[model samples]
Target chain A: MAETTRASDPGTGTATPDAHTAPLSEFDRDTAVRRRARGEFETVIADGWSVFGAVNGGYLKAMVGRAVAETLPHPHPATVTAHYLTAPRPGPAVIRVETVREGRTLSTATASLTQTDPDGTEVERLRVLATHTDLTAGPDEVRTTAEMPDIPAYEDCVGMDLAPPEFLRDAPIVHRLAGRLDPDCVGWAVGVPSGRAGTRGWFAFADGRPVDPLALLMVGDALPPSVFDLGLSGWVPTIELTTHVRALPAPGPLRVALTTRNLAGGLLEEDGEVWDSAGRLVAQSRQLARAPRG
Target chain B: MAETTRASDPGTGTATPDAHTAPLSEFDRDTAVRRRARGEFETVIADGWSVFGAVNGGYLKAMVGRAVAETLPHPHPATVTAHYLTAPRPGPAVIRVETVREGRTLSTATASLTQTDPDGTEVERLRVLATHTDLTAGPDEVRTTAEMPDIPAYEDCVGMDLAPPEFLRDAPIVHRLAGRLDPDCVGWAVGVPSGRAGTRGWFAFADGRPVDPLALLMVGDALPPSVFDLGLSGWVPTIELTTHVRALPAPGPLRVALTTRNLAGGLLEEDGEVWDSAGRLVAQSRQLARAPRG
Candidate 1:
């Protein structure tokens, strides 16, 4: 089967020549930040991460997470919320971080990403607030009423590259990451939407870099808008997104489910859940976005 | 019929002398903000709004919303996310608002609430970011895959005052707002818990005030922690909460459903949806909070 072959192909599954030997995966390199001052860092929004004409909201959030994690005493982000002010293009940007408060168990901080235009004007693209804590220090007790979506086996799912959606064909980020869309949820990909507002899929870095707490921020908003399944095809710009990292993901492809429960007043809310290879819920997210234009 | 009686008693259902004659409802009077200057406002954290020892998270968010709405070009908060830093006692506080951006369709602002101590120390309580717009100007179209929970009728549910739990015996907020708990989901109130992490309830001001967009912020976090259903009964301090107000609710009691799906690493997330009296979805929210200490 073409789907099974694409899932295992070394070129697609592991983009790096040697996953174990690579110093930094493409994701880490693209989202890398350099400390310039006490609370300021410099980074670049690399090319090929755009969904339509703007950088992915989750990718921008990852940059904020990296900067925040470096400044706070606690390393892992427990909860992060980012508001997209302007769609940032691929270019040099600066991140300004501020420590809001430090508590016994958690520390809170706020950060903003801005890009300078040739006119010397700075444009604020994203503003974020996050609370950080050491995940390892948490209690071992685990209790959950959440369950992962029932997706087909890794090899049975349809690869993104197999029959690329019209809008996703030229998007480089799709190639940088290996993803599979559950056949049941991708009816819209073939011009016959299931008339539902949900999507289930699998995700992993093509280079095989292990998923971490920081990467979970990216995974939260990485899926296509669930509205597409309802035959609403257009760019659904996110107004705000909030992510809660529950645990460190185990090494393997992650399972993801996205659902839109309400669409009203030209806006919709998308709720997502991500589970690790071990079938443990790793993160949950909710985002508000504009419905596709009429 | 104790539950039914409590739900309609004049003292509990409508505490005010006259719903129409009263100049201001208790909620508005308590949440009222006085303009101090441009982008600044003064308010008091009224005594009866605390959940335990701290003020309700939603109440605090409503204060921020009021302040932000006053400074921005838009009048209603479309999306608001607040990070709780320190719990402020019932006292005078200051709200500082700043316009982050103003666009044709939306305007974004950030605000902070700080309380002063007797020692002249100013403590930061909450930080918020919000996007505001004229909700009435939005398109009238509506579509939803979400549905209200399968809750009993207003009079069939058990009133909070019918059999007040031990922890809620002294909570003034419970009395200020009349609430009914879904019988099947409130087993934790007694010796036996339902062993689930969900709660459905009906909420309205004890003073017979109409529901609005700003008040929806309070409704989002007004319910008790859903974890109580799982026998995890203690104070769950919210770290952060994000509420998206979809529409101005029709006048009447609001229907609320809260669910906690995953609890891990001493942290849990609660997702809530609120529907107005007209049975239209008005708001959606997600909050991250500490799992009650073992």
Candidate 2:
């Protein structure tokens, strides 16, 4: 009972990729993005693949959204932008794709993810820029003027246990939080606060797999930064990111919200939303970080 | 009277790039992103440089942040990510720069902006991924748990005059609305709208130019989108865009909101906020549009 999987457990949501609880070979060896054979599309970044150590810009933007969803024929991923040039180390990474407008319905690619050196020479790090479509028809015209924050019903919030390391302590992303968070962002990230700058609850992954759209594009930088509740902390990284899926997420436990109003100078801006336990409003995100240096 | 230039008229905040207000040689020839002599940094996608007619992913991420602020020695542009790959049609758009991860303090570049097909072959359209720092120090720590959205002060908003042709009705950015918006996304958008989406006020640049951080990166896609208040209209392009500058905005009228919760399938997600009329909170954006098709 991953906490009794809720929102009435619609469709029983099954992600079907269990090598042993959603390992799907680290999403096909380090997050879904493929195309290596010396043709730009690699991933190995495994050495903790961190969050406070660096290597979690949504798991390298799901390795550039599975390398722009394998050069898009169309499976859905409408947008994904990542630009975190520095802080990237674990090992073996190369994702140099670039199609830029593939169209049928819609497609666009640009994957960089470098850092191969050893005379193999690569060294870039983050530059995912994407867009792929086929959102299952759905929009002739739909409407929503922004409204999905009224939380407190993921069985009534509050439940978090994050530690990262036991080989990522079973990483795929599975935060239940909502006792109002921001103890310096998931610092034993407890929960229960929606006063405003943000935090809403429940998200699934550690093998409970379900949400898709490239794992909701790694759940939009996977939380912990609503600018650490204004006091400012360390390892804030994440230099650039953009995600927008809009629909195709409705399984179990997805309702997330991680907001931020703004932070200047050292620059910080964050915003996110993901509603799915049948609530709809699938994905939306915002990023730009820098704080925790000197 | 530029409508009394508000927020109690702070320092008369005028960016002075006049040729009749921030003409700025069209941002050094098509949006502040220079470096061309056939070396490889270019910009020419003009012919109305659209917003609904296409070609405005923040003016191609300010032409990849003026070509990564001319290969980063740092003049500022800490982050700018654009990923639109379609709707490109107005000519000579080349911006191929890639200096990923350069750091003395911070620098990351990756401009692709192509579209050179006559016979030579290039075709890329958009992919500006940047981060260049040295924003003149001054950040050891700052605090602002997010708060700045109580707008409607800029002379009380509502003063728009859009035409979209007088060579894009003089576009170098200039909008003023807060008389409560959605007039059809800054309206004068002319006709059709009964749905509901978003819109907010006060933004400047029509040579008013006094909001730097690269013009707050073109005021995060310079308005006219909230999906035309859901009645749904054309030119909602913007395939992907990410901007986050945060603070440096202080001159005059700056307090924008522009929201959109979700618009599913045809896919839409817009979120923007810029508040600096001495109010603080400077640049934050989100884009992933596509709702003008059928």
Candidate 3:
């Protein structure tokens, strides 16, 4: 009955009466925005893109990135930072982008994602500042001191979609993407905990869509909080997140490593690095978030 | 002749006509902002707090932080991200702050530092988004998996102020603060590049002022770019910087470690960690900057 209902569900809408029509990729469709006016866009915060009732911060950032990318002359977001003012539910949202500075090499813009409350009051959910540039035209020099995180091969890792834990069974977002966690990093899933603060995994869209600069934002925060490995459980809300797109990712699953260094004064800082299948460092992110209750 | 004129230099202004008067610490006086109106402030970007010709990014951030802290109910800036639109020289500037959200545990604000150009056009130099809260009221739990960067004792390190480098002699900002760098990290100074991208040092104000939350902002970007150790040269301009204040520093010189993990496509991401004398993590920062023209 569940599988039959999913076929006709309006949220997925993958099966239509007209069998000849093709459907959009989940990422592209959910992140799509329509221009309302000059520098203004409207989009819906689609279902199944949320965690623990609130829309995922990175997914919201990707939506804003799409709006900012459209308004700028550049083709990609080079560096972006978003501050979560308040979490919004699955509903309609308005993104307003303002050009801060448009240089020949790089252009900077500010975007605000706002949603209206039931009481007819509009509240801003997320505020973003991003600089966009054409990655192909950027300098070709490559030098890196950071190494790609060492993790088990995709086939050797534990597939999250195969059997998600009880707590994550209600999280539709987890099912939307295919993820494989490092065995050592998932000790907390069992009765034993690692007592460390780090998570390494490989990720790709469930629909096998190609990842782009905008998609990198979502990948940055897609994993479970690193603190979970240390036996801490609860929702870890991000206060501010910053992502630097180092290069356009190559095809294939992206490898990600999230590590928390300092957890003090009720706050913790998590640093993440994403490497493409080609073993190229594609993106880096750091976020400050409130510690979990437990 | 230079010694005789130093006493009357207005930039330092430590020697005044009234010898009995005490002077404000450089960190305090330089970051001071006067309220001009509601949610508005005016402050000067002092001359000594600059590198090359442009004012330092961290110093500018500290000044903007002061304004944001004043308007919010919170006392300390918990997390702040600043995007440098354009580097401003030493001059008077205006800071405009707006309260975005005032929650029970945290308050969020946005600040803009604008200065009038010689053409009489007002230009925004720096834009910042910060969340503030009282660190003392935060959760007492502490869990850290990151270890402090190991370096020799402060007395064994190379004092940058003792024999200033030729390139740094003109940079007054270096002299305003005393720094001792690890010998291994300063191989680039003598033309023997280490081929590594890391720098560890001890830092404190030249006037012996205690480091505070605001000063941590300056220390985040105080050291020379870590790429210098890799034989890179030229001024590395910061595009966007995010600093998380984990805790207030315990009195004494700060132990700072700056490391660049990746440098690609004419941009690099540098991560910094600041540990106070009490061996507590005080701040963590990550910045995306343009690669130096070597």
Candidate 4:
């Protein structure tokens, strides 16, 4: 469903099929498909009207990596930091990528996406840094992280859940990857594309659907809280997401062992490490998420 | 020497002492020390009468952590992020720290400092989050990191000839722990408190002046170029510093292995893992540093 901009103001008017009676399409107007010779990925966005309560910062970051991979390299890793200048959209935007360096051992690339109003005023801008490197056996540093906490299965978790847009049902990939979101339980995750160092995966929800790589990344942003949402209960919307993939594991189910380090007076943070099927450290992510709730 | 304000409007004025020219005896007047104890760590301020060509966001972050440590735990590791609200003072300002959580394994804290106008209007605000944890040799989940990079001696770097702060020159602890700042070179470091798991030595300037922990932290922050700065002739200021100390090594001669993972467009990050003489991993750190021209 393409949004029809009011010919007068591009920012006004939605391309909804019906004013009030129709359900919106799963493939909303913001959905666009990128078909590259090497790789093809589809992108869907919110025009500031987030599927979740807030615009998804992690989704945009993961998309930048995905977009770069189309013309760059596969099975690559990236360390991305996106400065959220403005809230992203649920509508279509352009993602452009350029190669930076490609050595035998490593490759680098840059990506940016932007959205503008009909008058050309900017709405969003996203910059990404990604790298692809060869897999080599290291001096063999290995550390076994905490065990995955026992939690209800996905089926049971789904039954107990309640939240916004139900786009997750179609994105089972993220759920299988991130697993259940039990703040109190440990999540066990491992990297896919095994043998490559520094890669990890998690199960998450997307637009209320099962989580995939992008969704998992988007929802995984947790930080210590402040007074911004002083009266709120639970985690705050993540304002930013910075992640690094250290190892890539073989394609398989993974586990992410998560535990909260501290939360008090409306601020909290957690220490999470992702492991591969063999229990190897694929990646370690520590986010300054919002304060855990009562 | 404290500034004395008359009974005037909050927009009042008073003669503040020259922070730099003041003797060490009046150490409280040093803006850096005062800021470390109570100023904003990092913020984006509208250009004004500050001294540095570019306002330093890095120093604020490091200093805020030090300020928080006074009220938290000693020698605790912190992973903090400061959202740049406004540019910081090239002049003087105060900082404040708060303990958010004091857990058994870790402690969480927040610090914020505001820079104000002579009229007491706000200029900028810095928010910081720090975490402290007790070290334990739990179950042997062993993992090794990349072998330490090989480099030259402390005396060989290009920056050595450049002038360093006089305090740095007199502080044998900084020299013994981090070596003189030259260009990219490897140096040996150890905790000042011998037998502790961290690098040690008395680092304050030659005159036995009070030391600032923020200064001590930066000593070990000297890292080689991120691949981005490898061929470029410039320097980068870190935007954030995240340090994790697993165990306190018996303080004595400690070693810091520094290396860089370069990003495109002069964006770079550095990672360092500290080890005891026995090669036990004492702590590790990652910094979001900028790439600056030499």
Give each model's whole-structure lDDT: 0.84, 0.63, 0.84, 0.41
Question: True interface contacts reproduced by each model, as a fraction?
Answer: 0.85, 0.77, 0.92, 0.00
Model 3 lDDT per residue over A205-266, tens place: 76666678899988879988898988898899999989988889887778999999788988
Which tens-of-lDDT digit does each residue in B75-150 have in candidate 4?
5543444433344655555566666445454455656667778898864345455555433423333333334334
Evaluate residue A146 in candidate 4 and report its C-alpha lDDT on the 0 to 100 scale. Answer: 32
Q: On residues B1-294, what C-alpha lDDT tens digit does candidate 2 reach at each position?
A: 244442124335454555664435333445644566533675676654453345556756776677677777777876677776655777777777877677777777777777767798777766677777876674745556656777655555544443446523544233221222423344425555545566767666433446578767767677667666665666677777777776566666677777776676767777787887676767777777776663
lDDT of 4 by residue, A213-290 (tens): 332233334211221122223325342345545454433333554433323223233334544445444544444343
lDDT of 2 by residue, A174-194 (tens): 332212222333432323333
Candidate 2 iRMSD in angstroms: 7.0
Clashing pairs in 1: none
After best superposition, candidate 2 residue B186: deviation in angstroms? 41
TM-score winner between candidates 2 and 4: 4
Predicted candidate 1 versus true structure: per-residue lDDT over A61-162, tens digit per residue: 998899999999998999898889988989899999999999888999989999998899999998898999999999988898787899997778887767
Steric collisions counted per model = 0, 19, 0, 103
RMSD to truth, every model: 3.9, 21.3, 4.9, 16.3
